[model samples]
Target chain A: MRNLFAFISGALFGAGLFISGMTDTAKVQGWLDVFGDWDPTLAFVMGGGILPMAVAWLLTKGRRPALGGEFPTPPAPKIGRNLVVGSVLFGMGWGLAGLCPGPSLASLSYGGFGHWLFVVAMLAGMMAAVPLRARLAEPAEA
Target chain B: MIEQDWIWGFVGGLLIGLGGAVYLLVNGRVMGASGIVGGLVDGSGMRTVWERVAFIAGVILAPIPIYPIYRTVETHITSNVAVIIAAGLLVGIGTRLANGCTSGHGVCGISRLSLRGITATVFYIGAGGITMVLFRHVLGVI
Candidate 1:
């Protein structure tokens, strides 16, 4: 039952990504190109997405999940180094490829060999992150 | 068709939000793509691997049936292998380090008014825009 809902939600998100032109690298690049011919469609998507989610967050308040698990607590408000550095790195990659994680996975079937290569590399990077993060955290701990 | 893209984008955004909402309200988990797959890559989510796989399966498979009807999926990603690899690595590592991606931070966090989410979104988008200017306009590499 839990898995079923997970699947359904994933499907919905996938469908939305496709319909929103997020699966298109050109569209994403255009949006990022604020100095160039800026595409404002992504803003609409962001705003539209936020509306329902804000309400959903509200609904989650003082409530447990309908399923048999505790709802995730809100993340602490602390602004850390990892957040800044990671975001900058992620943004650079996003600008270069115009493909974020969601679209990267969603576009696999239609995206061909090049997309496959990207996914493989992305996975390698993910694996490397565990050690990389530990090394990054070491200095703080010390 | 192009001029009215915002409409479709908004509609799609709603679906994406609804998906996130469902994932949170029912599954008691944040709908973060990179985190989900990252757990699989880093061996941290070994116990709940099936659930992660199920969600990913939905993301990958959902588009197939809907492709015929929607048909707006084109990712004009660069064919430069080096760029692709670099971008992929950056995205993978960056998302993991940050512990979130566009979906997790941008949508889920921002909707909840989490400062971390908003900060990540701003930095990423800002960095992406800068990268675009440097690469596309200034350097002309990508």
Candidate 2:
């Protein structure tokens, strides 16, 4: 049941990306162009997403877990260098490729050859993290 | 038609976020799209498998309803296939290293006001941006 719910949620997300012109690299690139031909459409799409998410968060606050299991909401972090650094990286990538991981996967269903490249590289990136993860953990222990 | 395209994307993203939140609320899950899909091949329980399949299916089929109102135009950006693949691999590695994707960290985690999530999300976004700047501006891939 949990898996089913997760799948449906992903589908909705992919569908959303497809409809929002997010999967279209040009649309994303347009947003990245700060000075020229600025397209604010992606902002609207993001805003649209935030609205519902905000409400959902409010409604679920202090509520017990609902799926007959515990939901561990991770602790918030202090605003620090990590936040600034990560956002910059994310924005740059989004600007360059016009395909974030989520949207990139959605583009695959449409059978775009380009999406295949993105997905394959994404998988490779994920695999590369294994060593990085071990290194990060080692520092914490030491 | 163009106007409608934007509308559909906005609305679709909104709905997907809402659906994902609700599913998470009801199912005691985080609604990480990639994890759900990944679980399908990992031999999770029947319920999980079904949900994962359904979510992916919905993603693929959801756009059908909106297709009539909007025609998508393919973007033309020239880059070597190998480069694109490398980028995707990097993203995949980043997600795993961070323990979540954008949706899981950016959307769901951020919504819950999680600090680690926020940190991880920052890393994901930052890494992406740096990669883009290097690829597009410095390296001139696109």
Candidate 3:
């Protein structure tokens, strides 16, 4: 039952990304291009996404353990190194190529070498982080 | 009145939010695309692999239905393969390190108004915007 629900939800999310034209890399790139022929399509998508999510957050607020399982821990409040540096790096990549993971998966059907290349390289990059994160977790040298 | 692109963006955004909200309401998960895929790849999410697989499957399956209705969603993705690959690598590492992306931080994180989410969003957007300015206007590499 839980898995089915998750599948359906994922489908909805995917559908939304496609219908919103988010699956189109050009559109994402256009939005990021801000100075030249800037497109506000992503802004609406952001607004459209935030409204209901805000409400959902409200409903789930008091439900510490959540309805189905123990709630995942909220991210720490402090502005940390990983968060800032990672975001900057992601921004550079997003600026370079508008393909983020969600759209990348959604647009796999489009099947261009570029998308495939990005996906594979992205996976490799994710893998590279495993040891990096492990190293970060180790105690600092004296 | 907004253009068709904006209208579709808003509607699509709503669906994305609905998808995310449903996942949270039922599964008590964040439904973040990067985190979902990244965790599994890194092997941390192995315990809950089925749910992640199911969710991703839905995302992949989404375009199948959407294609019938929204034929010809044009794309202007970069043809530069190296740029695409590098972007992919950066996004992969960045999201893992930063812990979120557009879907996770831009939508899910900002909606809840979590400090980390907001800060991360600012940095990524700022960096992306600046990168675009330099890349397009100054560097002209893009």
Best by DockQ: 1
The count of residue-pair clashes in candidate 2 stands at 31
Q: Poorest 10 consecutive residues of model 3 chain B by lDDT?
A: B68-77
Off by over 4 Å in 2: A1-4, A62-66, A76-96, B1-9, B34-50, B73-79, B117-134, B137-139
Q: What TM-score against the true fold does each predicted structure earn?
A: 0.96, 0.77, 0.94
Error of 3 at A137 (Å): 6.2
Q: How many clashes does the backbone of model 3 have? A: 0
**Per-residue CA lDDT of candidate 1, range B1-142, in tens?**
5566898899889988998999999988999999889999999988878778888888888888878888557779898999999999999999998889999999999999999999999999999999999999999978
Give one digit per residue, the lDDT tens place, for model 3 in A74-103.
875877677888899888888888778898
Better of 1 and 2 by TM-score: 1
- What TM-score does model 2 score on chain A? 0.82
Error of 3 at A48 (Å): 0.5
Per-residue lDDT of B6-108 in model 2, one digit per residue for the tens? 6766786696577667666766666665555444433333456666666666666665565556676454434667656655655554455455565666677
lDDT of 2 at A25: 82
State residue B8's C-alpha deviation in candidate 3, in Å: 0.6
Top-down TM-score ranking? 1, 3, 2
User: lDDT, candidate 3, residue A17?
Assistant: 93
CAPRI docking class of candidate 2: acceptable
Instruction: State residue B12's C-alpha deviation in candidate 2, in Å.
Output: 3.0
| lDDT of all predictions | 0.88, 0.61, 0.85
Q: Give the 10-residue window scoring lowest on summed lDDT in candidate 2 chain A.
A: A81-90
